[model samples]
Target: MKRLWGTECAPAWRAWLDRATEQIFRHPDCGAVERELLDHLEDKATDLMRIFPGLTREEAEQRALEEMGAAEELGEELARVHSPLVGELWQLTRFLIRAVLVVLAVECLWLLWKFA
Candidate 1:
């Protein structure tokens, strides 16, 4: 998944977030969810590092990932909540509305030309 605001993140964390967010149907919502998950992961890692002063940053991050459980399962649960069918329907509706507006604009322009 693409990182927001060009912020750098660990490769492992990025990979896990990508796997989890990929299951979401709506692309727009994926970014928000990824950001939220990343915040949680970072907070967990920070707590771990504080608790264990000797632990390296990478080690702390690793422990946090382990605590989060499997990415695929989390993704599947997220997918269910996001609803692929609803996302598809929303996309279709937006496209149809745009097309209708374009058609109406052209018809109005033609009518104005005919009257003028």
Candidate 2:
């Protein structure tokens, strides 16, 4: 499974979180929701690292994941409260637009390199 947005180094925990919350991305308030989730994770990681100064970023991330509860259960709960059918389509469109821009940027860079 792919890592969660902020858990790039903690694949073990990230896989669980990513699988659980994959559907939440379609929620209308996805930007707010994602920001909240990342903030929570950051706080948890900071606390873990403070307690164990020697802990690596990955280790802190795993500890934070453990405290955050199972991703599937949490995802279900959040989806129930937040997901909107029409909003899903809107969210998807926004994501696609962003992705296309990124691809265009990469292609432009590649072309510039070739022509230079």
Using TM-score as the measure, which candidate wins? 1
- Would you estimate the TM-scores of all the predictions? 0.68, 0.55
**What's the lDDT for residue 85 in model 1?**
88
Clashing pairs in 2: none
Considering summed lDDT, which 10 consecutive residues are worst modelled in model 1?
A: 1-10
TM-score for predicted model 1 compared with the true structure: 0.68
- Top candidate (lDDT): 1
lDDT of 2 by residue, 1-116 (tens): 34334434345654665656666655335445656776788889999999999999888988888898888888788777676865766678999999999999999999999999
